[model samples]
Target: MDWNSFWEGSKDLSTFALAIRAIILYIALIIATRLMGHRQVGILSGHNYLVAAGIVSLAAIRMLNPESSLTSGIVIVFVYAFVNIFLSYLDIKWPKTIDRKPTILMKDGIIHRKNMLDCHVTIDNLLGQLRLKGAHNLSEIDTIVLEPYGKISVIKKPEALPLTRKQMNLPPKMVALPTILIYDGKIDEKNLHAIGLDHEWLMTKLREKGIANPKDIFLAMLESDGTVYISI
Candidate 1:
């Protein structure tokens, strides 16, 4: 057993070279993911999953095979990202053709046996999922839809649903999004500008909070109601 050859491949690329290659590919993948957008990470379709798998395979090949060129691997990663972006555009453009609609597996407290069979879901599996969703029996469920990603979405019967503010005749409250002002000690200028805030305003707020520098704060979030939350 050659320890040296085992630790470092017999090829021209050394262990250190492989480590650097892995790091470069890792950064490239991150950039590619950013280019593909948040949807690629949030809700991945079957084709999107395939694209991710293919990019991973390419990166692995580059790191493992000394004969593999970094340029070729990086090109493949970019190509996969671009192709996924294009496919995503097409999916949005023609959802009916590219994507499958959610199947109604249950309706009106009764299981749609044909849909269950078509989706390859058994009664036991359906019962297990129903239990996981806190439905004691089928009678409590008004509808159950099997999503394209193989997840179950359950809608409870009108009587079984939770009471809302509207039911109590309560006034609706204003809801606002929290904007990230500072993350990892860096100011998000675009977000700050979007909220009609400038650098001077941030500085004044930071100073009021006894924060001498933006780098001193780990995270700072501005709420919709003009409240700033700072964490060091």
Candidate 2:
């Protein structure tokens, strides 16, 4: 085979074919990433970032290699997909291995220097987050947690002279997050099953609200306190 002629022929393939391959690869990567879960995106730890980089790099290589058959590119995509799926299953089954260690930045109002060193976190980062949280001073904090997602969670210590409940004047309890049963006129069966209800129950609820079909409702929610709200 003449290598130069082969390269020339490969370059001569229709632009539409190249565009379609790019689109297909993009869609596959998106689906695979979503299947991996949102934690993969939020917690860009060293390991997680490496995994994401590897996936993108592989896809880009396959996209540029026009000489490689489409079937070969798809096979590579599926291989990565399968590996991700298997790892995700293992993580769910044995969470301890995949679970991240909690970095204790503070305990009993004292900073844990050892933990900070291990996690490579500096006092400046911690103080910056604290300031964002409206903490005027470190002395006001009782405890602080450096969450796996790189967020600093702070709790204020109770004052030496405790205030009465009435004096504190705490706000009323906020309502729980609404459960979306239907989105964009489609019944979310997985969400329904998660909340221990089925399609029949959903239909019955809709009928009571004068909605004959799930498609007629633009949004449907079930609050934790057993309140059902629907919008058409």
C-alpha lDDT of all candidate models, in order: 0.85, 0.73
Residue 19 Cα positional deviation in candidate 1, in Å, after optimal superposition: 1.6
Q: Any idea what lDDT model 1 has?
A: 0.85
Over 4 Å off, model 2: 1-9, 41-48, 64-70, 160-232
Per-residue lDDT of model 2, residues 84-169, tens digit only: 66665666687558646557788898999999998888888888898898886888788888876577788888873357655779
- Residue 156 in candidate 1, Cα distance off native in Å: 1.2
Residue lDDT tens for model 1, 1-49: 4334433344766677777777888899999999999877865577788
Best prediction by lDDT: 1
In candidate 1 the C-alpha lDDT for residue 120 amounts to 97
lDDT of 2 at 91: 61
